[model samples]
Target chain A: MTDNSKTLLELRNIYKSFGPKHVLQGFDLSVAPGQSVVIIGGSGTGKSVSIKCALGLLKPDSGEIYFDGEKQDSAKAVARIRERTGMLFQGGALFDSLKVWENVSFTLTQNQKMSRKDARDAAIETLKKVRLGASVADQRPAELSGGMQKRVALARAIISKPDLIFFDEPTTGLDPITADAVNDLIREQVQALGAAAVTITHDMASVRKIADDVAMLYDGKIIWRGPVDRLDDSGNEYIDQFVHGRADGPIQPSM
Target chain B: MIFNPFAAIGRASMAAFSEIGRLAIFTGRVLLACLTPPIYLREFFSQCMKVGFFSLPVVGMTAVFIGASLALNIYVGTQFGAEQIVPTISVIGITRELGPVLAALMLAGRVSAGVAAEIGAMKVTEQIDALHTLSAKPERYLYAPRVLAATLTMPILVLIADIVGLMGAWMICVAALDFSGPTFLRNVWQENIYENVSVGLIKAAVFGMIIAIMGCYQGSNSKGGAGGVGRAATLAVVGAAVLILASNYVMTSMFADT
Candidate 1:
């Protein structure tokens, strides 16, 4: 697992289960520094669970998570990893109680103890990177449109210029055009920051747009993974069926 | 059929025990977090406003009404000869038992439900998870502020309730029951003031801790969707109310001899 010096994050033989349902079983994946890895999977395929496990939000029953070449097991280790990582939850998960700017600069002000004025300025600057105007900074998340909220969340995720970022369905509720714009923005920001990114998404277009590498998760394991160019011709039936969005292939719709 | 019945009973008992264990552990964690550093002063003040200041009106109104009703009941129950004891009895009852218990019950309905709904919504929307990713401990940032505010504020609320309740009783007795206001006040002040008020305040603090803990425990464990949040709120209110009453009985027993 530590063979590659460039590997920024690795999940080795991870397993997670809730009650009687096993969500992840022996899941394995690795991401290199400055690379964007998009995990593609069908519904209920443990994509979110895997990301949560990696982030220490959910503890895996077995296996280890390596972040920046160090094991993340203890609470101290997890906190250190989280300090350098940013996450974009599927629903934006903006603190409804805080203004948009406050939400964006929450880590900066609360954890880093930055002055409010400085944090607000930094937040506005980050918002601009996501193509949001300064006018929206003082507004609440509910006041923004779905796309605008997504942009705010994106801004919040990258405001600290984290060493690693995780995006959970960044384009789930957006229209195709807005989704494409978000994908483009995410790609541009990740490239500019040169940070490793892990995006879990079911949107094929997003996978195509933001992924340097694509991994398919099915039945609690990564069945196929390679460069984005290899996704269409992965030669794995599960990956082929998923990428093509076909029902007749080896994967039957779970009823 | 026999085995099925036995298994069902065993499973239900185990679930109940597990739930109690979880709540106890959650309460311990909240206490530990309170002792730790990185206290969120802003959140604590906001919670104080929500749990204490904003609840003054409802707690006050309930206290006044209960006080008046208790006075009327005592006047009716007493013979003409024993009617002079009304003021002392009303004051003793309000401060020693009725004031703290009723105020806590009202807050359990109001504040506990609100905390559960707010935190449950946060859980459902992944804000709790978002906080974790931001390297913020939910127990420190969320639970400690709430528990500390509630525990510290409940005594003040009970103190207010006691005064309002006694005033209501005095007003009712003097105006309608042919009693003098000065005489009634004198009787209320002369009868075990320190013992009654102190016991009530102590109970208020303990009740406040229970309310906050139950609300947060149910809310933080909430799952599913809107339905789950609703259930959490309902359970929080019910749990807090029940715990307040049950603990009140235990506390009263302990304070009875004193």
Candidate 2:
């Protein structure tokens, strides 16, 4: 095995801006194989921007994003990199026109060119992995509860058996207990598949359950990052303020 | 005491012109991207079914009724000439101009509005972003299929429109206008040409592309939430209808002698 292949995805000195407002500035992060790296930040603090840049949805003004140690600057490389990753969006984002199984099997049917029956079988298996009943597969996303929709989104994300997965605000809108369940499910899936994960959320509860390593984003840079066990005693005031959910801290709101 | 309606109309007119200019440039870029391909055929077929097949009933009904009315009007005008001229003008006008144009406008109202609303909601819900994250190109997965389907199906719809319209005109001429069957049939066939049918089909195809692309573009770029999706749908239908009418004039003139 190659030395860098142990690290599934890496971002170095990434920068992105919209108009005059810079979103990501010299951000550096790496996900070791099978590691769950959770990024915690306030809304609009470049957490989603970092994920978008890695997926090539938003172009970075400067810096390198590497998938399996290969830079993702060229179109060919970007396509190659993206094919190995999957994402669960905040809203579940399932196609309303599609049945739940169709949504889960979308990538396999569309990108991988799998046959419909084969895709459906894979979708059912993934649903089982996410603890969704097989009977729920034929129903549309509109028929599902909020928590059920999230589970279906999880099924979709893992259906491809992606080497890396990005979870964007996975627990944002769910009730606390449901959120905790989702967090546990995320943890279980990462471990079961031995896939690296980068989950972005503001919820400290999610971070506690899902993160092997936690990174705190502020002002376009990662202000603090370490093993999850060290988050409480990171000795960084910013991390402390954020983890504790204090409004008044070293970090100030803009006027 | 009264608002200056003319000024509001003038401002709206200017905004519409500017939007047209901007969309033209955007369309050129999309077309350039279209040439480079890893064509997503299933997505394209799905969208084609959505935009074209699903839109048939509305377009067909509009054309048939319009044709019936046109025949009646032509018969009334034909007091200046032989009654046989009603069939000739009804077939000529409807086939060469009205059928394609009206079908397109109807599609703009029905299918384009639906496309805009659907995609706009998708955008707001981050479904498009989800597609991107799944390693699928949104343009290919979403827009290309829609554009291709509309382009392919419009000609067929317009042909159906022409036939159905002629039938409507025939029914009106025989029953309402008291024109004889043999006379109506002869005049209608005599006035129709391969060029007329081809031109109308061509116009329908172009209008389909315009409707689908405009809807997809507006929806894909929608901002905010419910308000944004509403605006996108409204704009898509209104803009597509206007473009269909404006382009019909231009296309009709181009194929005038044909």
Candidate 3:
């Protein structure tokens, strides 16, 4: 549990399951203002489920998710909470029918009720923030490469200047070089916005690049969490096994 | 590899039922979303144009041929000394039921199929997810406009079908049956156009709702990869067509004299 005052988003004793498969069991996480928390876990470790719960995409069987010191209970309150945050899904999730700028400003145009011309202008400016040229504004996501698509996704996430962001496997299928570039972009944007960030990923390199705080998940719980600099010496066996990318360690793999 | 065909079929049946349950829940949520804030008027109008105006040609063609055939059949029946009742049967058959139901079926094949494919592909590609992330309700952004448009436009399309079919019957009477065009027109207008056209429009409105709901529902609930999108498209057409015909019969019986 956090100190209650300094946290931007907080989850306590979260428990979730799908049928017989228990994906998250008593998972807890606290993200502070302007902090970059990267959650490292293997496949099916409840990372995605945890993020979905916080975003109201999935309801936890039993848990408490707080945003800005307020519980998201009523529809009005939930909408208010969502308005302050942005998300980058595992896939780019761009609207193929919409041009890149339109996709980027979708929130502003649709929710904020801005004019198309004004939203497009805002979108181009946001695109520039992610180091994309204005030319990409008119192109579709299909016209871009994988790396470019990620940048567009990033642009869309940051267009509203959200106070918090959730990145779901931000660099999952990218090449090493592109993945590294994305990691740097994530770090730069989070710092520029001075916003709290929670990223779910399995890439150790990505954690090193983007995370100020690192948390390792295993067997439906947070096995270890600490500052990124202390990751190598977390002294937790699961953390050590995962950080080293080794198959043999004190942590046993279930068949 | 112990394979039981019956077990496989049973599992498939269960999956189908599960899918239906999921769609019912989704429909409830979409209906709720429609009532919430942030009405997308522009999108709704655009979808109306797409579902209504663009679907006329196919529906028109089907209605004309069906009307001509019905007239010919009635004419043949008249030759057997049932001449006095031909107008009544033809008027009730084309305007009261066949025109709207047939037009709807044609639109379901043409419009519903396309809507499902478009929405299903959008679902798979993450456009729907993107909308959600942007704080846009996918239902309002995607479904509301489409459903509303289909509901409003269908009746108009059906009315057009009614007129075209009447024209087809006129051509049949004048050119084929050797009856004067004025007489055929007079008989159609006097005996049929009032009750039949009104009834047809009612059928068109109901059919429109069915087609749009099925199409939007299938597309919005599509799963898996390319194959999932393909299945959604197929299901939209098949489901809309069946519902259109079933609803047509139910409405006709409800409106017809005992």
Candidate 4:
């Protein structure tokens, strides 16, 4: 039951398949504005694919994706939708050829045609928001540690002040402290920007910290969804097994 | 047995056609991206430096040695009787064929492999997807600049290669063939200058486009991980070299009467 008026993004009956392997089948999700929804699922599930579908990075074989209550089907419409959204990739995905500042302000300089100096200043400001310093502006992504790289990526994601943001495994490969820092930064940034955020992560700690609502994706569909407070007591067996980190559950480990 | 053979042939033919169709679509997309707005001039210039300027030493070395060797072979073939004509033939040969073909082969080894590896790595690391999310078209921002740079700079590289090759031939002719230095230089300068050089340059441009397109295509489609990037690089070189040779044959035939 999604309120159409407040829903920023809606994906209905999404189906996506890669050749013989069916990845997503009848996946449905709806994200409201200013809300942070974390989609949790086991590895090899369609969590990332669902996010990609929402971002227009991957096209679903069948289904409807609506952005701001308007159907997005054409390339022009997808481009328009993407222009208003930001994404933090699992690997940070900072351009290796560019400096940190350039990577952060890439959308501003390349798309919005902002001057290099202004973009650099804006980038440094955004980096500050992510707890990074102005000194890192000139360095490359390779020069930064994993946590620092994630911070830089977060800065880049929030630099444009997008209406919507997506985080794919934001705290995948970091120490607990660093991961918590990144999670806090994400929560703060999403709240500060008042953007609709859909984070695909397996980190339950991240879900507890950043999620307003938690949706569990299984077999390419949202099997359970509710407020973050109810995530531990969702009364769904799959959600219980997943949240408690039990291997013995409805989900079988892939060989 | 008949059915099996027919099925195998059909499968092979289908695979070939599929590859060709994909390549055609990729080329069409690249052309469309080039014509569209928001061209990345900065990326284009950087690629020009990488694909053209940085390739000078290897291309130059290859051209020189090939030119010298060609001259020596021609001198021996003619029994050293037609000393004067040796410079003309060698110059024409280097300018018309060896310069562009050899330079392209070298670039196919160096530039194509490099582009494929770079783009493949970017793809694997999700930088390409990052570009898409940033509202920047990858073809315009990444592929077009490289393809355009290689296409534009190749002719210039080939022209320099032609000159250097002739100088190399001159060195051999004057020292080994006992030909006067001035006479060798004069023959090289006067022998069908525009026609020979233009043909080589044109071939170089076409070869450059092939190299870049192959590299970008293989890389942009790369999957898996480090192994995938390595495969892309290898495929880029092999595909570019084969295409370069095939295009060279067609180009030579077209310019045969000229």
Candidate 5:
């Protein structure tokens, strides 16, 4: 059990909807300090919304969010949470118009005191931590390959050494080998930062590689959660069907 | 089934009203960001260069050709004793009407389309969401600089266009119309006061704001994928043009005596 006092981030009974489509209902998640929690769910299951609500990127229709054990109900509290966190988007989302280093050092550039040269140098240093060479730092995001872009995004996310990091399908489009490498990099970097991580992905390999604990989202709420070691025997029919990749099960495909 | 025409009309009206309300709120937030901290000086200067400097050639070309054409048309139209007032009418028409309108229309096509496409792409790819998580307000980092730049730069661009346009009239008057260069220059200066210039510049500033707002609004609100971005660009240009013409009429009415 996670000590409530020690929770770095927590979402309690979040509900969000767009028009008539109810995306999240009674969704809850919590990440302890230095823990890696991977959320598993089918597409459109609001796995992403869970983390987005926690980050305050998407306001929940109803919920309470706490960061660093402080309730983020006020605008100032939400701003503080945003300032202390980093996110790696599914598409990498590097600014295509900016050079690689500029993309990596984006937050620092907003500081007004960091010279462009100094920011670029810091970006290059962070890139090396993700096993990228300085040469790639000058190239545009469009000029890089998919795997390289993911690494660059990882570098960007960790460049600030944030208190928490959120990854949205961090390995979605990569090759199996590249995905494994990124998963390793994510685990190593999160440990190095001593930061809690909440990742959203349905990729089972990713879950096994990166999650200290696993949470399953279904029908707009968390239905199952357990340590990674217990994932195979979670015994929840939904999770069992999901883990075994079975078509014949209680979980039905929607039209 | 059953198609109810009045119900459909009501729905359409409601949608349009909703869209207008959203745009108003969006513009309000951007304006507030303009006065707040973290103004993004580099982006402001960069947008100024883009909106004012880079647009010089297009604006210049349009003004010059229109000025020359107006001089010829007025010279031909007033073949009787009214020929002497050709320079005055040409100067008034260009500065008070054609110069600002043409320049803004050109910008509606160029700047609006570009801004819409770029911001639309960013939105679809989640860069805007990334900005949100990064603690960077998109209104501050993206919208306001462009808005402020366009607002400030349009008048400057129009001022240059006014000069180029007058020069075009002067060239035609001296070379083709047999008017004395000295008299033509003197007439243009004495007849066209600073009021004519200020009214047109004021119109240009408002038109510039419309272009930026339409572009950024359509763009940041865009979704889906490439098709969505394409639609945003199209809507931005169309919206800017419509608003430009509509606002131009309103302002002209407000300053009817001038």
Candidate 6:
């Protein structure tokens, strides 16, 4: 939990399930303005599900999602939350049908009704911000390599200058070097926008590079939440097993 | 687990009803999106080309062969009787029965399956979710255009099929069956071409909506990964085909002169 006055987004006492599998049980998380909170958890621990719930992509059977410290109880409120936030999905999730520039400026043209020429110029500038060349803008998503695609995806996520951003395993398929490069970009962008962020990733390097605070999820609850510096010494066994990447520990691998 | 036949039947029925409810809701949303302003004409036109233009060759080819064969069969069957009615009967059958149904079935295999696969892949890959985050409504941006295109294009496609089918029947009736080409044309023209063609086009529009809706429904709701997408595509084709045939029968009965 965070202070009510400063909290930007919060999922309070959330409970969710998929058929018989209870994915989130009384999970709670909050992030203050301009903070980057990385959710660290093992597979199927409902890490991504929590973020999805907050964004209203996956409805929680019972939960309250607060955006800008207000309860997102109405359809209008939920839609507004989504309209204001951006996400970088694990697979980049760029429209393969659209060119890189089109993918980046999708929200601009679709949501804001920006003219094509203006949106394209904005897309090119954003691509440049992500270190992508202007020549790369006309290419399709499939034409780009893994790293360049993530940069394009990041460009899309930041183009609208959202006040809140979600990154779902932002560096999943990239090589170590590229992954680190992406993490740096994510860090710089989040800082530059002064936005609140909630990211779910298995990559500790990503955690260290981007997170100001860290939350550990296990058994459908946030077992630990603290500043990133305290992740190793939080003295929580689940955090220990995950951070050290040890197979034999209290945190048994899911069979 | 014990096999309880009654419970199993109940569960199956409930699942079927649930699926029907979901489809109905999806159909309503798609229709609503189609009617409202801010319609994405670009996507609709692109889909028209994809659903209509790309599918023309196959539907047209099927129509020609079918028309030729239908005329041949009618000639053979009528040898002991009114062989002169072959042209009239062939034209009627093509417009009233074969043109709309065959064109629809062809599109079910092509457009329906293609939409399902593409959208299902997008679902699994989180492109749909990405769209949500970007403030784009998936129903408006994705489903509406495809549905509108199919509904608008199927009628035209079926109309073309009817003409091409009549041409095939004419060629066969004159060249092979020894009927005069002018006589064949006169026979078809004497019949109520307006009624039959209109019936077929109406049937086609309904079938088109069915095809696109089933595809969009199965695709957007697909789960898992490649397997889920494959299953969605299969379901789309199957759902569209079955609905098209069933609706064709219903419309035929309603429009029957008897």
lDDT of 5 by residue, A1-255 (tens): 233358888889999999999999998888888888999988888888788788777888998989987998888898899888999999999988789999899989984358999999999999999999999988999999999999999998998889889999999999999999999999999999888888999799999998989999989999999999999988899999988888788777654
Q: Give the 10-residue window scoring lowest on summed lDDT in candidate 2 chain B.
A: B26-35
Q: What DockQ does predicted model 4 obtain?
A: 0.92
Better of 3 and 5 by lDDT: 5
Candidate 4: where are CA atoms >4 Å away? Answer: A1-5, B1-3
Q: In terms of lDDT, which candidate is stronger, 3 or 6?
A: 6
Q: Please identify which of the two predictions, 1 or 2, would achieve the higher DockQ against the true structure.
A: 1
Q: How far in Å is the alpha carbon of A82 misplaced in model 6? A: 1.0
Please compute the TM-score of chain B alone for each predicted structure, in the order given. 0.97, 0.89, 0.88, 0.96, 0.96, 0.97
Error of 5 at B90 (Å): 0.8
CAPRI grade of model 3: medium
Every model: iRMSD: 0.5, 1.2, 1.6, 0.6, 1.0, 0.7
Clashing pairs in 3: none
List-wise, what DockQ does each model earn?
Answer: 0.88, 0.69, 0.51, 0.92, 0.77, 0.88
Model 5 docking grade = medium
lDDT of 3 at B40: 80
Docking quality of model 6: it rates as high
Docking outcome class, model 1: high
Query: For candidate 5, what is the DockQ?
Result: 0.77
What ranges in model 2 sit over 4 Å off?
A1-6, A253-255, B1-45
| CAPRI classification of candidate 4 | high
Kindly indicate the candidate among 2 and 6 with the higher lDDT: 6
lDDT of 5 by residue, B112-156 (tens): 998999999999999999888878889999999999999999999
Taking chain A by itself, what TM-score does each prediction score? 0.97, 0.95, 0.95, 0.97, 0.96, 0.97
In candidate 1, stretches whose alpha carbon ends up further than 4 angstroms from where it belongs are A1-5, B3-6, B81-83
Better of 2 and 3 by TM-score: 2
lDDT of 4 at B42: 94
